[model samples]
Every structure is written in structure tokens, then in C-alpha cells.
Target chain A: MEEHTGKKNYEVDWNEYLPGVAIDCVIFGYHEKVLKTLILEYKETDFFALPGGFVLKDENLDEAASRVLFERTRLQEISLNQFYTFGSLSRFNPEPMRIVMQKNGLEPTKSHFLLQRFMSTGYYALVDFKEAEPIADFLSDSCQWYDIHDLPSLLWDHEQIIQKALESLRENIDHRAVGLNLLDDEFTMRELRNLYETILGKELNRSGFHRKMVNSGRLNRIGKKNTGKAHRSPYLYRFNT
Target chain B: MEEHTGKKNYEVDWNEYLPGVAIDCVIFGYHEKVLKTLILEYKETDFFALPGGFVLKDENLDEAASRVLFERTRLQEISLNQFYTFGSLSRFNPEPMRIVMQKNGLEPTKSHFLLQRFMSTGYYALVDFKEAEPIADFLSDSCQWYDIHDLPSLLWDHEQIIQKALESLRENIDHRAVGLNLLDDEFTMRELRNLYETILGKELNRSGFHRKMVNSGRLNRIGKKNTGKAHRSPYLYRFNT
Candidate 1:
């Protein structure tokens, strides 16, 4: 889309000799004890994929991931990070990609220049689904969140990509504060507990969970909500930091 | 090293593509509370690097890392897992690389065919110093462990590679047993404490540390270490798993 200057930059020429690498994003969101991952359905094949876009030549890996998350998901200025880079040479199989590319009247062998040697870095964003709307871009038909356990088969190494992202999320729980990314501005403590239980795949003891949750010092109790079915009013707490 | 002619055969033209990507090992060893990393000094320049060799075409990323670790550092059959992949388009700079190639009487412009690509995944192994013997390879003039805290400037993005490996190590400490990777078959409880202190960059409370450690049931007390100057013999323990 842009032109190179009159003088050829050897660096540019060097890049032309190499295959391009890109980044993909797997955004996870939680609501009401259900863990879901944001995915896009491509127009023709109805094939589902994590909402992803290519990395720009000038962007850093981390920035590229954020850019894609914002552009495709309509969720801007959210925190995202690089978790892994999938680089198995077999990832570029034309047989699987041929179905999708050929539908657009493109030759898999000639038009897919970046496929053979390309590597993709996977990044993940933990965001609230209530704040996100799927923006169908060039290749997508619709965007939606699928339950982690009930995901449709994905293209390329996407299944493995989601698996790795979940693993990274589980491992990072102690150091990273994920609740803020997935929760609403104000929510009941039970809502927060349900979110953790779903992501961790286990039930937490109410008393013990409350103790640890308070000790983390990130919660601010605002008010209580009287759900008519409950004996006591459930307190609402917002993430302070 | 082996051809793929099995039931799940994937047919592709090998010659049209660049050579398969490889992994490099940077094994770190600790002794006397000082961290050390294995390095191989190359010819024609004062620059040095971690003792690393090529990954075989047919091997998995982890296997390739272990192979390089064993073949070059003489740390045989040790496990080394992939931590990060470094593959920026400009990662393989041809400018200074050309000089190095020329110094070795090779035409850099022609010889370095994979100048812009050649993505290399970096893996790290943590081993006890007593088990390793660094050997000189084709490009290596010497092999030895340099103190990690006082490392000389490294080639490429090797510094960032080391940082990522260490961060991964820290994240895995709670769920995975990393102490076993750096300890001998048997060790004293004090020695284990020292190792944690060095890695965590903090001094732990003796009673608190002992309580948490013993409760974990991962250590088996063998006997006692007879310190001649000490009033009481210190207990010695071995990792149970």
C-alpha cells in the first residue's frame, strides 16, 4: 500500500529475502461462571478462528498484538501480551489453507507468499465481553465468544494456540491480576468468585476464598444488593487497581 | 536425520524452502550462590556466546535444544525446554555478520543465504556445575561458565533471551519442582535454602521457609551433615521426587 524510496534500503532487501512473521491474539473473557474465548467465523467456510490480524512491519510484537485486538474486536486500549510463538514449519500446509484462499480466487502456491516460512507469535487479552463488539473485517463473517470446553474446530494451529494461552493464564494467576480485565466496573463478590472458579476449574471454599480475596487488597466494597431470594444483601465490590 | 515416509506423510518440496528452524541452548549453572552461564568463545572476534549448536532437521524443538546441550556442553541426556523464539525480520543483520564471515574467509553476501529469516528458538537448562564439561566446537575457542550477574555484552538478543528464561523459571517455582534441576542427588536443607535465596533475590524466614517446605512433603531427610565447628549437626535432605 506504500512505496519504497528511490534508494533501496539493504535492510528492506534483506527482509524481502526472508519470509514474514506475524502475531495472532486469543482474547479470553468470563461472565456468570462461564469461560469463553472470542472467536471469528470466516465468511465462506464458516470456519472459526481467534480474532487475529497481521503485524505491521514497524510494530513491536506486543504493540502489534494490542493493535489487532483493538481493530478486530472493537475493544481499544486494553492490555494484552505475547505468550508464545508457534513456528513449526508444517504450520504452513497449503492443503488446509487452500480451501479458504481458493474460494477467493487466489492461488495458494503463488498468492500465499508468507505461508511457507512464516511464524506467528500468539498474544492474549483478558477483557470483559460486555464492553466488546466483534467487527467483521476482511475474512470474517461473525464474531462471538465460545465456551472454552465447547469450541468449534479452528484453522491452522489455533487449537494449540488456545491451549497454550489457557496454560499461560493459569500459571500467571499468582502474579497477574486477571479479574480487572474480565469483570464489570462494579460487581458482587459472588460474581467475582464464580469467575475465578470457572477459570481455575475448581470450587473455592467461601470463607477461605473471602480471606484471600480481601488480603489481595485490590477489592473495594461499595454497596450491597438485596436480591429478594437471598437472606442477606450481597455486597458489591469494585476492583480498585 | 530420518525421512518421513510413514502413514501420516506430509509431502513438500524441501529445496524450495529455507532450512528448518533450530534451537540454541544456554545452560546456566550455580555454585556457591553465584549464577553462571555456559559460553563458547568464537574465533576472529573478542565476542563470546553461550555454548550452542545446530538443531537437527527432524528433531522437535525441545529435542534439538537437549541435543545441542549434550553435544557441545557434555551435559548428556539432560532436558532443555524451549522458553522463547527470537524472529524479528531484522534479527539477522547482514552488515556486521558479513565482516565475521569475511574474517573466516567466507563470502557473507553469498554464503549467508538465510540472512533475513533463520528464526532460532532459545531454550535453557539449569544444571549443577559438577556435571558439565564444556567442549570446543568448530567456531568455539573456549567453553566456560561466566557469572550471570556480571555477563559481558551478548550477541543478538541473547540477553533478552536469558531474561525470558529466568522469568519462566520464577513463574514455574510454585507448581513445578525446579529445585531438583539445580541440586545434586542429595543435598542439605541449608543448601536448598541458599539456592532459593539466590533465585528469589530475597532472604526467607528460617521457620516460615522450613514449615512450608516440610509441609510440601517433597524433601526426604537422609541424615545429618557433621560441621566440625558447629554445636549441632545440621540435617541433610534429598529431593523425594
Candidate 2:
């Protein structure tokens, strides 16, 4: 199979792809106190989707997800958590997928593996928004970050996948120390609280949240934020390595 | 394909099974302060494994897992959570699987779909130990429960599957009210702590644990447990319904 770009053509051997397993990644990034996810738009179409790829027969599923993440974000060794596996027969809608294949200059019916029902494992990673440079693959028009609340209509079960990933993220926020990955190395308590509020989609009590954070032993007081106003400056903290 | 037993032979059509996706259930039960998992032993062999089954083309994977759980336990509507999917290329050990097939009167090479690699989704359900009647399917000689700490050698990455399930269980124990399913309707504080300790495989600070549990707002103090001694009586609690 060849990915037809305007200027270049990239070849992918269909036979080398695994028959029934695929990986879709929900890459969560925090920007401007809002939680966002990286998504790809199909060229010349309104379709948006999670960055996904088929596993190679020789690779593990986690490795396949890592490869997809690295290709899209140009980052490596980012911890990816496998949250759920979506195996419903209706996960793949034939109409939109066919349109996508046709637009990419491929015949969907001939791609038997792609046409058949397959299971997709959802993996999520929290990344610093500014650190990731989203690059679209040849099959997509562009890769962009969308705020979780204002997402476009996604194709297939990508919206549900994002929801599940978000649920997993919220369920694990307090226990997993994910702020280390989503926030800067040093940040004010307000930034951390905002990150949690954004992901959890709720307003947490300020004093109680601060007390819980301080008692968790996962953070260390590093310095004070140098706000222009002296009386309003807050202590900055970092995740204890 | 046929299941050969001492009394009768059962036939199954290989074509009816889903091609590449399967479900394995790690059914966990608690008894005598020890956490145990239900496993099956194949007839005329030492191979033990988690109770598992293949999905049907018309059924969802979760439905397939539920069916497998119901068949093994003679119970239905047991809530099972999908924990992880195992898709490593080496997950299926060919030698052992071939022996299992041959012993079951299946020509492995002739069963192309069975011989080819497949992916399995792992699910776990917590059940009351005494409430479950372990029944072996035609493929196995007997079904039994084994203590998680003293597990027998399992077949084909099942040990890893159980380990992953245990990890997931431990991670969710504090957050989700899973004790509602694992414990009796009413219990003492010590019993609740014991259940938590058994699932977590560690001892927790008694007063701190109790305080956290009480503050979580998921429990209700129904009454006091009269242990036949004045000093030994403890508060009986139930999960807030």
C-alpha cells in the first residue's frame, strides 16, 4: 500500500501488517490550563481521528503504540498506559473508512485486513504540550491538538476511545503522578490544580486539595513563584524524583 | 471438532469461532483471608490455566467473557472488568498449545485459524468464594480454585495475565468499591481491612486505614458485631447502596 502525498509517495507493505490487532493512541497534553488530545485530520475531508496504526507481526502491541506515538510526536520513552480494548464489530464504520481509503487512492475492498473486523487496544500518554511537535502522516492533511471539550466530530469510535482514556486519566490522576509528565518540571500549585481540574472536569476545593497534595509525599517544595505582586506569590513545587 | 469425555462426545464447528480475538477471565474469589483465582486443569495433563473461551462473530468480546464466566461458575450477570489485552508475538507457546490440541483430538495443522496467532483480552471478576460452584467444561478434567500466592504453573502467558489482573485489582481496590462484590453484605472493620490487605498483598496501618475508609463515604455502619465478648465487639458495616 502506498500513501499518496501531493509531492511524495510512501510505500507500506500490507502483507507485513498484523492481521487483526491495531493500536490507537490518546495523547493528552495540557495547554493554557486546558487538557487537550492530539488528533489527525484526513486530507480534503472533515474526518478527524486518533493517531493509529496496525501492529507488525514481529512487534508487541505496546511497541506498535510507541512507534505510532513517536512517528506523530517525535518523542521516545514516554510512558504509555494501555487503558482499554475496543472489540465491538461496529467499531469500524464502512462508509467513512471507505471514503478515507478512496481519498488516499486505495481500494478498501482489496485491503482485506483493513476491511475485516479487528480489535484495537487504547493506549494513552500524558505529554507536555509545548514539547510535542505534531506532524501529520502522509495519509492525513494535518495533525493538531484539540481541547477535549471542543473536539470535532471524530470518525469511527475515536470519540468513545477518547472518553474512555479520559476516564482512566481521571481515575488515576491522584495516584499515578501523571502531573510530572503533563506539567512543567517546576510549576505553581495553582497550575497543578488547574491541570487536575481540567482533566477531572471539576472544580476541586482549594485548601483540601492543597492539603491532600502536600500530604501525598509525591511533591517537593522547590521554590517560590516570582509573581510581580509580592503578596500573592505562591510556592512552586516539583515531583519528587 | 469434538470434545471427548468418558460419557459423551460433543461436536463444535471451528468456523463458528471468531478468527483472531479471544477472552480470558481471571475470576478472583476470597476465602479465609486468602485471595484465590479460579483455574482449570486439562484431563491427562498437568497443564492448568485460567478459564477462557473464544468469542463468536455475532457476540461482543465482553459478552464472550461473561459467557465463559457463567459457564464456569454457573452464575450470570457477574460484572467483569476488562483489564488488559495481551498481544505479544510470543504469547502463544506453540509446543504446549500443539500438545493440548493433539490430546484433544484436534489436528493443529488442519485448524488454520487455531494455528495462526491470535490476541486475547484479559478480564477479571470478583466473586464470593462459597457462592461459586466450579465446573469444568468438556476441554478440562476439573476446575478448582488456587490461592493467588501459591498458584500452579499456568499455560500460555496466563500466569502473566493473572499477575496483570492482580496488579489492576490492587490499583483499583482503594478507588472502586470492589469489596461490595468480594465480601459478604455485612462485615466487621477487621474483615474489611483483611480483604483490602489480601487484595493488596500488604499490611496497612490500622487506624489510618480505618479513618480513610470511614471518610470515603462509601460505607454505612449498620450495627455492632456481637462477638460473644464485651471487649471484642466491633462495628458492622456495609457498603452504602
Candidate 3:
């Protein structure tokens, strides 16, 4: 707890940040066929939020989002797509955030940057769940993945952020090869379908889905996976790199 | 010129605006089979910019964007999709904006809100070219459409904003029914294909494009369009309701 508080003491050049702009990332991962998001719990309060950071003065919005993602997940070169900019007036409901800051021994009046209205741009990235190592920021107690269907009480408008991110993901599933980011280098066709079903929140017809997927030309028929299950093993495939 | 300057005198509560957040819209229209974007020429300078406005404290970002669009185009109930948020430090680039303001008799020192850094969220809209009526704002001399390929020198990062909007539009054309917004309610398949090619910046094989369009199941055959040209007329179609 002391270490976390001390980490916040490092002076940030406030001028380098745009007063009213921030970046919130919705990092979606597929684990055990369940869609999850990376979240952080504040050290002194029970408030949870999407892993986010303010845009640096010299950085582009996308670059800022990538920096936040890398800082949290320790993964580089992962692509992030901008989906929506959340700028509702009530988005920065400061009561909970103020409480968290007070509990962390920082006065709300002194932290001008935190109290100002923030219009956050939402950037989402799909990453392999097994490869991501979630690390909490200095102000947070723990960083972990939560099932999107059963999320904890989130701070600010993070719940809405997650919902919008999910909507964007579902709408873009076919248009973009997003599943490739969530799956392994090689996976069974069944695994791929399950991943889609999880994100889409609906079951897809097997034969129709298979035919459509094959015709999409985004996948390559790789070698078969030898699973020790009962019947004949399903063929494995990977994204056309 | 007097009327334009008088319009800017309407008292707006600067404190009621979010300190540094703004919205810029790229209103895209297709005319004469050439893609064009709505632009405004500042009254005091030859510089042009996307029709943009600051975010009111009580308004959502989308609402602000919609207001800007409606104020400029005089159209309501049109949907605007957000593509990206431009937050680069140099995005404001005050020199040109300052020049325009001074030329309009606005003292930059007195206009606190205008001089501050703004992180603007970019929203784009596809509109039927014939239906839209572009109007210049208080500080602009004219509001008109310019062919995207032959755009004039624009203010700040507006050129970059338009480029990003075009990129987003091209990528989402197949995924979303963007053509529906840019075309008349009922149009021929050839008109649809031409619209696609204009945005995509390339020609497509006629037969293959027709096959793909038909397979997409987004269009409904309405009737034959009597073009009155010497050749055979083509079938008219409308988007599926």
C-alpha cells in the first residue's frame, strides 16, 4: 500500500496533457470461450475502471491508447482500433473518484487535472488471453480480468464504455479479422466458432457458419489438430497472415 | 459581413462549455460521381476548415457534433458516426486560427475559450449531395463543397481529419450501408457501383461487383429506371427496409 502511494509521487508535467482529453482502452480477451475485459481496482476504494490514461501532449490519440495498453498488458505491436468517443457531460461524475483520491491521501482540491471534465476516446484491442499479463497502475490495488457478462460495480461510465466496445466488436467481427487477435496461432474450427459465438452472444448455425467462414478467404486451412477426443478430430486453421 | 460578425455576438456561457473539448465533422457527399466534402472559408483569411463547434457542458459529444452538422447543413435526424478523436498536441496549431480570429476583429487575448488547446472528436456523415444545403458560420465567408481530390489549403489539421474520415468511410462501405446515405432513395445498380468506386478510388469489374452486391442481400429490386439514354435501361433498387 505504501509503495503504491509512493509511486504516485512522481511529478507529471501537467502541461504535456490536454486538460480535457483522456484515453480509455477496452481490452477484450477470449478465455475458455468467455469474453473478458481487463479492469483495475483502486487501492483505497472498491471502485473499478477500464485501464486508461491521459494523452501526452506530444503523442497522437492512438499512440496514447497503445501506451496505456502496453503499460497494463506488457504487450507491444498489438493493434488498437478507435471505436467511439465518450463525451457525455455526466461521464466524469467525480464523487467516487474524489473519494478514492482522498483515501489515497491526496486532496481533491489540489488535483486540478483529476477534477476537470474529461472527454475520453475509446480504443479497443483484442488480445490472446493467455499471453496478456495484467498489471495494476500505481493508484490501483489489483488488475484482473472480469467476465463481461458478470462485471463488478464499475467507476464512472466504464460500464457504458464496455457495452459500446462490445457493440463495436460484434458489428466488426465479420468486417475485420478480430478473432485472430483472441485465438492462438493455430486453432480448431470449433474453437474459432465458439469464440465468435461468445462475442456475438448468440449461437451460429454450424453448416452456414462454416460455409461463410470458408468463403471469406481470411482463413487458411492449416494442418489438423490431433485431439484425443472420441470421434475424428476437427481440422485446424489459422488466419491468413 | 456585418451580419456574419453580428451573429458571433450572441452571448455564450463560456464556463458552461467543457474546457478543452471540441467536435469536428466531415460531411461527405457524392456529386457528379465525384466525392466531395463540405468546407467553410473563414471571413478574414483564405483558410478553410471542417464545420466544427465546441462541446457544451450539458451536451453529449454526439449531440454537439449533430448540432454542428445541423447548423451547417440545415438537416436534422441524420445519423453521424464517430471515426476518431484527434488529440495531437499540435492539432490546435494556433497561428492560422489566431490570424483568422484577428482578421475577424476578435482579440485572441480576450477570447479565452478560443485560444485554449482543444482535443476534438471527429464525426463523419454521408449525405445525399442534392439534399444538403451548406451554410457558412459566423466567422466564415462561404460554406460549399469541394472535390476531395482538389481541396484547398485547410486550417489546422483539417486536411488530416478529412483524410482519416475518407479512410474510415472506405473501410466501412462494405460493412455498413454507407451508400444508402450518399445516394437517392432509389437508384440504379450502376449508380450504386459508381458511388462505391468513387469512394474506393478504383474501378471494379462490373460482373463481379454486381454478383457481390446481389449476394450481400442489402438491396431490393424496385423497378426499371428509364434513363432515356439510347441504350437499354437498368433496374432500379432501394436498400432493404
Candidates in order, interface RMSD in Å: 4.0, 1.3, 1.7
Which stretches of candidate 3 lie above 4 Å from their native place? A1-6, A9-16, A174-180, A205-240, B1-16, B90-92, B110-112, B174-180, B204-235
**Displacement of the residue A123 alpha carbon in candidate 1, Å:** 1.3
lDDT of model 1, residue A138: 52
What fraction of the correct interface contacts does each predicted structure contain? 0.10, 0.63, 0.90
Question: Which window of ten consecutive residues has the lowest lDDT sum in model 3 chain B?
Answer: B1-10
RMSD of each: 6.3, 3.4, 3.9
Q: Score the docking of each candidate (DockQ).
A: 0.25, 0.64, 0.66
Residues B1-241, model 3: lDDT tens digits: 1222233433545676777788899999987689999999989687888898887777888888888888888888888988888777777577777787788777777446788778888999988788889988877899999999999998888999999999999878975558778888888888989989999999999999999999999889987788787368889888886
lDDT of each: 0.68, 0.83, 0.83
The numbered model that scores best in DockQ is: 3
Ranking by TM-score: 2, 3, 1
What lDDT tens digits, residue by residue, belong to model 2 across residues A84-195?
9998877855677678778888777855566766688999999888999998987789999999999999988999999999999988897554888888888888898998
lDDT of 1 by residue, A1-241 (tens): 0122223222223233334456778889887888888888866886777776554445445666776787667677888766877766556655655666565455567645534445677888888878888676455567788999999999878999999998888766644458777777778878878877888889989989888988988789987776774658888898885
**True-structure Cα RMSD, model 3:** 3.9
Worst 10-residue lDDT window for candidate 1 chain A reads A1-10
lDDT per residue, candidate 3, A36-107, as tens digits? 999999987878999998876567778888888988998889999888888887786878778877776767
What are the chain A TM-scores of the candidates, in order? Answer: 0.84, 0.93, 0.92
Off by more than 4 A, model 1: A1-20, A53-56, A89-92, A114-118, A174-177, A225-231, B1-24, B51-59, B87-95, B117-120, B174-177, B226-231
